[model samples]
Target chain A: MKQFFIFVKKEFFHIWRDRRTLLILFGMPIMQVMIFGFALTNEVKNSKIGILDLSKDEATAKLSERISASQYFDLVENLKSSSDIDASFRKGDTKMVIIFPEHFRESLLHSNSVQVQLIADASDPNTATTLINYASAIINDYQDELMGETKLPYTITTQTRMLYNPQQKGAYNFVPGVMAMILMLVCTMMTSIAIVKEKETGTMEVLLVSPLKPIMVILAKAVPYLLLSIVNIISILLLSVYVLDVPIAGSLALLMFTSILFIITSLSLGLLISSFTASQQTAMLISLMGLFMPTLLFSGFMFPIENMPIPMQVISNLVPAKWYYYIVKSVMIKGLGIEAIWREVLILTGMTVFLLTVSIKKYNVRLA
Target chain B: MTDEKVITAKALTKKFADFIAVNAISFEVSKGEIFGFLGANGAGKTTAMRMLCGLSLPTSGEATVAGFDVYKESEKIKKNIGYMSQKFSLYEDLTVKENMRFYGGIYGLTEKRIKEKSQQVLADLHMEAEQNKLVKSLPLGWKQKLAFSVAIFHEPAIVFLDEPTGGVDPVTRREFWEMIYQAAQNGTTVFVTTHYMDEAEYCNRVSIMVDGRIEALDTPTNLKKQFNTASMDEVFLQLARKAVRQAD
Candidate 1:
C-alpha cells in the first residue's frame, strides 16, 4: 500500500507536469460539448420555400400566410412559372417549392377538392423529412381551423413533454454523451499509451525489476487518470448545467458514482490494450480504433442504437460505453435512479470486472 | 560470507518457441563481488541477465537470485535486486532529484530516507548542482551515471547493469566504473553485462557467453592464460572465431 501511494504520486507528477496532455484531458470535453451543442442542431427553423401561387385567391393567400407565420418556413422566392421550380431547388436557396393549382379555391369550394404540389429538396434526407413534416402539420392545422365543425374519424396526438429539457435542447443530450466519450478517451487511451511509453523508453523493465509490485505499478498509473477523469466529469456537468442550462434531473451523487464506474471500465480497457501492445503508437492506434470508435459510434453518442442493424446492436451490447451512455442519459435526462437503470449499471459493473480481471491476468502471464 | 551464493544457476535455459535464447547455461556469483557477464550482440547475455533480474522465466533449468528461487520467489528476488537497462531508463521529463525521489519512493523508501539518500547519491556523483534540471537536458555521461545511481538508490542486495556504460566516452566509463567499485565496496553485489571486452578485465570474475552458453568463466588472468592471449579482447575474438568455425 505504501508503494502504491508512492507510485500514484509519481503518476500525478507525470500528469501535472505535461501541459499538452493536461489540455487534452480537460479542454477537449468543453470544446466538444460547446461546439456540438450550439453549432450542430437538429431543429429545423427558417427554412426557405419558393411559392407558385397559381390560384391567386383568398384561400391560397391565407394558406401561404399560415405557412410563413409558423416559424418553420420562410417565403424566399415567388416563382413565375412551374419551370422555375427545378432551378430554384438547384440553386440551393429554396429548400422546398409549394405549387397552387389553377382555380385551387374554386375547386376546394365547388368540388370539395383541391390539389397542391409540395416539392422538397432531398439532398439532405433528414432535413428534408423534417421540413415536409412541419409543412404538412401546419397545413393540416389550418385545414382544421377552416373546417371547425368537421370531426375526423381517427386522430392521434403526441404530447412530447421532453421532461428535463422542455424545449428539447440539444445540449442536454450532447453534454452527457460528450462527457462519456471524452472521459473514456482521456482515461483509457491516455493511460494505455502512457504505459506503452514506458515500454518504448525502456522504463518498464526498470520498474519491473524494482521492489514495486506489478499490480501496484499499474494501479499507480491508473489512479491519477481516474482522478482526472472525475474532474473532467465534474467540469462537463458544471458546463452543462450553467452554460447549457441542462439540468441534472437525478441525484448528483448517483451520477458521480456511475461516472467513476465507467471511468474504471475505460481505464481497465486501456490497461488491457497496453498489455498487448509494445509501442505507444500501437497502443494509441488500438485504443482509438478498438475502443474510441466503438464508444463513439456504437454507444449512441452520435447515432441512435435502435436505428442500427441487428448485428451492430448485438455488438454494441459488448461495448462498456454503450451501457454507460444509457446510464448517463437515464440518470441525467430521465432523472432515473438505480432501480430504473439497474440493468445498465450491472452491465457496466460486469464489464469493469471482466476487463480488469483479464488485464491483470495478462499482466501476470507476461511477467511470468 | 553467509556460505550461500548470491546467485546460482544450473542449465538455466530460455526458449522462444523453437529457438533457445539461453541454452542450458550455468554459473554462480558470490555476494559483494563485481561479476561481469560478457558476450557479443545476440550472444544471450541479456537473456541471462533478464532471467537473473527476474524479468524473464527460464524455460528448462533452475536458477536462484539473492538466495530466492527464480521461479517461485521471483517477486521477492526482484525486491532484493536493482536493474539499470542499456537505455537510460529514468523519466526524462522529471528533474534528477524528482527521478531519484520517484524511484526511491516506489521502492518503499520513507520520505526522510529518500531525501537523505538522494542528497548523498547526488553529492557522491558530483551532480548536486544539476539536480533541478530535467534529466533529458543532462549530458549523456551524467544521465548514464545518474541511471546507475538511481537503480541502486534503494540499496538492494544486488544491482544488475545491462550495458550500463554503452555510449559514454572511455574517460566517463572509467569514472562510471569507479562508482560501481564504490557500490561493491559498500557490500552491494554488482552483476553487469557488457560488450566491451576491456570492461571484462575490471570484473573480479568474468564469464564469456557464446551462442546461449557460457564458454569460459574465470578470473581475467586465468581466462587470458587459458586462451593463450594477452588481453580479454583477444580471448573473446579467438573464442568467437572458434564458435563460428564450429558452426560452419
Candidate 2:
C-alpha cells in the first residue's frame, strides 16, 4: 500500500509538472461540449425564407402571415417576380422560397385545390429536411383549421410523440456521447502516450530495472488515470444535469461504476498501443487515427449504426466506444439497469480482458 | 569467502531470433567489488547487464544474482539490486529530495527512513542547499551524480549502472567515481557498464567484450600488459581488430 501511494504520487507529479498537458486534458472536454451543444444544433429556428405572393387575396395574405408568424421561417423578403427568386437565393440570405400562384385563392375557392411551390436549398440535407418538415406542418395545421366546419369521410389525424427525449434537445444526446468520448480520450490516449513517452525518454528502462515488477509498474501508471477519469465522469454528469438540464434518470452509483469499467477498458487499450509502439508520436497517431476516429464515427455518437451502410454497421461492433455509448444511453436516457445492458457490459469486460492480456504478453516478450 | 560471489552466470545466452545479442558466456563478481563490463556500441554489454539486473531473461543458462535464481527468483533479485541507466533516470520535474524520497519509498522504505536517508545522501554529496530545486534546473553533471546516488540510496547488495556517466565533464566523472568508491567501501557491490576505456580503469576489475563475446577479463594494468598496449583503449582496439580478422 505504501508503494502504491508512492507510485500514485509520482504519477500526480508527472501531471502537475506538465501544465500544458493538464490544460488540454480538462479544457478541451468542456470546450468541445459547449461548442457541440450550442453551435451545432438540429432544431431549425429562424430560418430565412423568401415569399413570392402573386395572389392579391385574403387567403394568400393569411397564408403569408402564418408563414411569417411561425418560428421556423423568418420571411426575409417578398419577391415581386419569379426571376427575383433566383437572385435572392444566389445572395445566400434565404434558405428556402415559397411561391404562390396567380390564381391560388380563386383555384382554392372555386375548385378547392391550389398549387403552391416550396423550394428548399439542399446543400445541407439535415437543415433542408428540417425546414421542409416545419413548413409542411404549419401549412397542414392551417388547412385543418380552415376546413373545421366541413366533415369529410376517411379523415385521418396523425399525432407524433417523441419518447425519452421529448424536447429533442441536442444536449440530451451529446452530453452522454461527449462524456464517453472525453473519458476514452483522456484515459486511453493519454495513458498510452504517457507510457510511450517513458519509453522514448528511456525512463521505462530504469523502472524495469528497478525492484518493481512490470505488472506493478503498469498498474501504478494506470491508477492515476483511472481516478482522473472517474472525476471527469462526475464533472460531466454534474454539468449536464445542472447546466444543460440533462438528467440521469437511473441510479447515479450504477452509472459511476459502469463508467469506471469503461475507463479501465480504455486504459487497457492504451496500454496495448503503448506496448506496440516504441515512440510517443507513433502511439499518439495510432490512438487518434486508429481509435479516436472510430470511436467518434462508428460508436453511435454522431451517426446511428442502424442507419449506416452494411459494412460500416458491421465495423461499429468492433469499437469499444459503441458498447460504452449504448450502456450510458441505456442508463442515462432509458433509465435501465444492468439486466437491460448486460450484453454490452459483458462485451466491454471481455474486450478489457483481451486487451490487457495481449499487452501483458507483449510486455513480457519485450522484457525477455 | 567462497560464498561472497554476488553474481554468478554459466553459459548465459540471449538471442533475438537469429541474432545472438549475448552468446554463451560465464563470469562471476565477488561482493564489494567494482566490476566494469566494457564494450563498444552493440557489443552485448547492455544485453548482458540487463539479464544480470533481472530486466531480461537469459535464453539458456543458469545465473544467480545476490543469491536469487535469475529464472525463478527474478523479483527477489530485483529487490536486492539497484539500477541507474545512461539516460540519468531521475524525474526532471521533481526536486532532489523528492526523487530520493520517491525511490526509497517505492523500495518499501519507511517514511522516517526515507527522510533520514535523503538528508544523509544530500549532505554527503554537498547538495543540501539544492535539495529544494527541481532536477531539471540543475547542471547535467549534478543530475548524473544525483541519479547515481539515488539509485544506491537503499544500500542494495549490488547497484548495476548501465553507463552512468555518459555525457559529463571529467571533473564530475571523477567525483562520481569517488561516490562509487565510498559505496564499495560500505560493502555494496558495483556492477557498471561503460564505453569509455579510461573510466574502466577506475573499476577494480573489468571485462572487455567484442562481437558479443568477452575478449579479455582482467585488471586494466594486466590487460595492458597481456595485450602489449599502452592503454585500455589500444588494448580494446587490438582485440577488436583480431576479432574482425578471425571473422574474415
Candidate 3:
C-alpha cells in the first residue's frame, strides 16, 4: 500500500506536468456545461412523436399525416389508447403525443371548432416547446387548406400540457449530458492515454521488473484519475448552478455517489483499452471511437435513444454512460431518490465489474 | 568468481505459438560476476532476460535467480533483481530526486533509507545540485546514467541491463562501464546484453547467442584465442556469419 501511494503520487506528477491534460480536465467541463446549457439548448430535429387519434376521423388522419410529412417530426408509433401515451413518454420514444377528440371533423363542420390536446413530455422543455409549435403550425396549415375548400372559416385549438415539469427551475438537460461527456473524456480517454504512454516509453517494463504487482500499478494509476474526475464534476455542478441557473433538486450525497460510480466505470474502460493497444495514439483513437462516440450518440443526451432504430437501442444498453445519464437525470432534474434509479445504479456497477475483470485478466495474460 | 551461484538455467526455452523465441539454452553465473549476454538483432537476448527478470514467463525452463525459482517464485526473483531496458526507463517528467525516491519506495525501502540513499546517490552521481531538475531537461548521457542509477538504487542481488549503453558517446559509455564495474565490485552480479564486442571485453564471462541458441561462452580473451582472432569483434563475426535469422 505504501508502494501504491507512491505510484498514485507519480501519476499525479505526470498529469500535473502536462498542460494539455490539465486543460482537458478543468477547462473542457466548464466550457461544455456553460456552452450547451446557455447557448445550444434550442435545437430540435427529427423528433419522434406518437399519434393517439381517438376520433380516427378524416380530419385527424389528415392532420397526423401532415405532421408526419414534415421534416421536423417522425411518426414512430400510433399509440392505441390514452394509457399508452404515458408509457410512450416514459420510454422516451415519443417527444409529443397528439390526441384528437372524437368526431373532430363532424364537430368542426357543425360547431366550427375542435380541441386537439398536445401532451409533450417536458423533461426537456426546449425540445418539447419547439415540437409543440411545429405541430400547431401544421394544424394551422390544415385549417387554411380546409378554408380554401369551404366558404366558412374553421378553428382548431391546441391545449399544450407540459408533463412532470410545469414550473420547474431545474429542468436543464445539459447538466447530466455534460457530466457524462466530461467524465468519459477525462477518466476513460486520459487514463488510457497515460497507461499507454508508459508502455510506449518502456517504463512499464521497467516497473514490471520491480516488486510491484500489475494490478497495483493500474489501481494506483486509476486513483488519481478518479480524483481528477471528481474535481471536474464539482466544476460542472458549480457552473450549472451559478451560470446556468440550474439547481440540484435531489440529495447531494446520492448525486456524488452516482458520479463516483460512473467515474470508476469509465476508468475500468480505460484499463481495458490500455490492455488492447501498445501505442498512445492507438489507445487514444480507440477510446475516442470505441467509447466516447458511442457514449455521446447513445447516452440519451444529445440524441434521444428512442429516436434510434431497434438494434441501436439494444446496443445503447451496453454503454455505461446511458445508465449514468438516466440516474443523473432522475436525481438532478427529476428530484427523485434511489427508489427511482436503483436499476440504473445496479447496471453501472455490473459494467464496472465486468470491465475491470476482463481488463485485469488480459493484462495478466500479457505479462505472464 | 565466488562459489555461490546467483543465476542458474537448465534447458530454458520460450516459444510464441509457432515461433520458438528462445530455445533450450542454459548457463550459470556465480555471485559478483559481470556476465555478458551477446547477440545480434532478434537473437532472443532480451527475451531470455525478460523471463529471468520475471517480466515474462518461460515456456519451458528450469531457472533460478538469487536462489528463487523463476516459475513459481518469479515475484521473489523480481524483488532481488533490477532491470534497465534499451529504452531509458526513468520518468522524464519527474525530477532527478523524485525518480530515485519513487523507485526506492517501490522496492520496499524505509522512509529514512529512501531519503538518505537518494541523497547519497545524487551526491555519488555528482548531481546533488541538479536533483530538483526534471529528467527531460538533462542531456542524453546524464539521463542514461540516472536511469542506470535508479535501477540499482535498492542494491538488488542481480542487476539486468538490456543494451543499457546502446547509443551513448564513447566517453559516456566508458563512464557507464565504470558504474557497472563499481556495482559488481560491491558484490551485485551484473547480467548485461550488448552487441558492442568492445563492451564484451569488460565482462568477466560472455555468452554469444545466434538464432535462439548460445553459440559461444567464455572469457573475452579465451573467446579470441578459441576463434584464432586478435579482437573480440572478429571472434563474434566468425560465429554470427553462419546465422540465417534476419534482424527483427
Assess every candidate by TM-score: 0.82, 0.83, 0.81
Which residue pairs clash in candidate 3?
none
- Summing lDDT over every window of 10 consecutive residues in candidate 3 chain B, give the lowest-scoring window: B238-247
Task: Name the best candidate (by lDDT).
Answer: 3
Q: Give lDDT per model, in order.
A: 0.83, 0.83, 0.90
Candidate 2 docking classification:
medium
Scored by TM against the true chain B, the candidates give 0.95, 0.95, 0.98
Model 3 CA deviation exceeding 4 Å by range: A40-158, A161-172
In terms of docking quality, model 3 is: medium
Cα lDDT of model 1 by residue, A181-265, tens digit: 8978998899998898898999998988886778888888898899888888988888888887679999899999999999999
Q: After superposition, which runs of candidate 2 have C-alpha atoms over 4 Å from their true positions?
A: A40-172, A249-251, A304-308, A334-340, B1-3, B244-248
The clash numbers for all candidates, in the given order, read 0, 0, 0
Query: Across residues B1-248, which tens digit of lDDT does each residue of candidate 3 receive?
Result: 68799999999999999888898999999999999999889988888998999878899979999999989999899999999999989999999989998999999999999998888888888998899999999999999999988999999999999999978999999999999999999999999999888999999999999999999999999999999999999988987887889889
Please provide, for model 3 over A1-368, each residue's C-alpha lDDT reduced to its tens digit, 9 standing for 90 to 100: 99999889999999899988788789888878877875533345678889999899888988898899988888899988999988998896778899998899999999999999999878776677768878999999889888889978799999889887674233337789889988998899898999999999999998888899998999998999999899999888888888876899999999999999999999999999999999999998999999889988889876777667899999999989999999999999889999999999999999999999999999999887
Candidate 1 residue pairs in backbone clash:
none
**Quality of candidate 1's docking, in CAPRI categories?**
medium
Per-residue lDDT of candidate 2, residues B105-139 (tens digit): 87888899999998888888789999999999999
